[model samples]
Target: MAAAAAELLSDEGYRADGRRPDELRKVRARMGVFAQADGSAYLEQGNTKVLAVVYGPHETRGPRSKALPDRALVNCQCSTAAFSSGERRRRPHGDRPASELALHLKQTFEAAILTHLFPRSQIDIYVQILQADGGNYCACVNAATLAVMDAGIAMRDYVCASTAGLAEDTPLADLSSPEEAAGGPRLVLALLPAAGQIALVQLSARLHQERLETALEAAGRACRALHAVLDRVVRERLREVAALLGD
Candidate 1:
């Protein structure tokens, strides 16, 4: 596996996709994709595609016991469609991986959102994977950020995320499916770029302490790059909405 991954980078330092070690896959995003939801967004990073929808800063449903007196309850659900990946999944939700991803999303957004302002209210965020390549968590974070922004919810800062891996002692940014399958140590980071704060960090596989800092720095750089792209998307959508309103 190491030998195969080592071959992934050419002598010219480009990966099989012709991207430099530090290069990220192209990011395309759109806001307000769903009219019925309070807010919605779609994002594509390379071949991975995700859609996110936000609903409510409204009264809690099902159980009033879940409501908080000092802050809004943030609930998140993340699921991949049966055909989202190369191998079809049997179930859509209620699986272990989906449950774990949903929990992570909840924790990530709770940190970025100004929950204190909406005491006794509930906010629901739902994200679905339409396609899967790699870096699903990062893509979900980016999509959720846009959806929340469109909902006009108060947030301290945008949450940007990216994945990094180490191959042959070289740090690689924004890993693709092939790279992820190569079995290298991987790190996922979700950041508040403006405040230089990290909302969440998860590591898969063992990484030596000596190389941890370098890998983390690479992930941070990729996250900041994603933030730039997401900012542009938001601004463009706002401009379009303004024009339509004026008309």
Candidate 2:
């Protein structure tokens, strides 16, 4: 495993994909990607791509039994397409991994959204992974953040997410699939940048106690960087809409 991880970084301090250890992959995003949905966004982080759509802040569907009296219900579903990963998946949803990701997304967004303002209602966030490389959850969170913003829902702050891995005692940010497959300890973080608050943190594999702080710090920095990117995308989208309305 160490050998695989060592190969991830070249002698020149670049990853096999030619990225510096601390650098993130190219991020491309657009808001209001779907007109019919209340809000929608598409995002690509390197080879990973995801689309998120938001609906509601309206009356709860299904049964009132599921409704929360004091705050809005946040329903989230995260799924990967059959061809998203290298190996084709037989089922897209309701599986263990997908269900777990859905729950994580719900918890992350609940921390940032102002649910109390829309009591007895529900907000549905649906995210689909069209392509998978690494950092699928991070990509989903970032995409969902844009979708929520486009919906004009009240949020405490933007939720930005990123993944970090530890290799040879050095912390690496924004890991790609190859880097992730190298069997290193990985840390994922979702942050509310403006408030300097962490919405979610997930650690996979195991790392020495001494390395935990460094990994967390690296993930936080990456999340902040991602927030900057998402902010720019939102501003650009708003400008385009303004121009269209003016015409």
Candidate 3:
């Protein structure tokens, strides 16, 4: 429908970023990035970068009515840098989309966290996107998982997330911004990797019924791969902490 436009997928089936259909972007992450917070982590997936910080299993503040009787209340906030991307020049935080993302973050963690252990308490997760190449939500979830771990919070399992998009019958793993803008079918999935449980699934655009599983499986595989990267980051952080303590 357009002239002089770069294809989302090249003739050889490689994405614009030159990744294979099932290959994820390079993932790099660090845990305990902030000493003041209960837990903090910074993560980068390709060019999408996010920071997450966790504060408190502390007593709930404000209205007693807001406290959950059976589990700790999970509060989440998400913010994106005004200049995170090429065209995003204004503040997007606190808007409708940001609020919805915050809600999703809250829900994603609620399923993974052993919230019952901290009943009547509050756990706050703050996620900030420092860069916005694509897959913002997935990056946020992965960063938050590491942050929660850094805080020593108990969770049912490690939460990992990834996004996939279907292009011309090929399901692309870890959709980049350009791929997402192509307006094809996209799937976002968050998983408790060890439990083989899906914490969240978000689909955008219409995908064939038969292809849904393919897209989901692609996303799941990417999530499992992320689990390995996150696990490595956490372990490396622990070793660093242990070394400092030993010294």
Error of 2 at 227 (Å): 0.7
Expressed as tens digits, the lDDT of each residue in 125-158 for candidate 2 is 9999999999999999999999999999999999
Better model by TM-score: candidate 1 vs candidate 3? 1
Best by lDDT: 1
Off by over 4 Å in 1: 1-4
Question: Could you tell me the lDDT of residue 21 within candidate 1?
Answer: 91
Model 2 clash pairs are none
The lDDT per prediction is 0.93, 0.92, 0.90
Candidate 1 C-alpha lDDT tens digits along 80-143: 9888988867888888888999999999999999999999999999999999999999999999
Write down the worst ten-residue block by lDDT for model 3. Answer: 1-10
Residue lDDT tens for model 3, 1-247: 1221237777776777888889999999989889999999999999999999999899999999999999999999999888788884565678776788899999999999999999999999999999999999999999999999999999999999999877766778998888888877789999998889989999986766888989998999999999988988988999999999999
Task: Output the TM-score of candidate 3.
Answer: 0.95
Off by over 4 Å in 2: none
lDDT of 1: 0.93
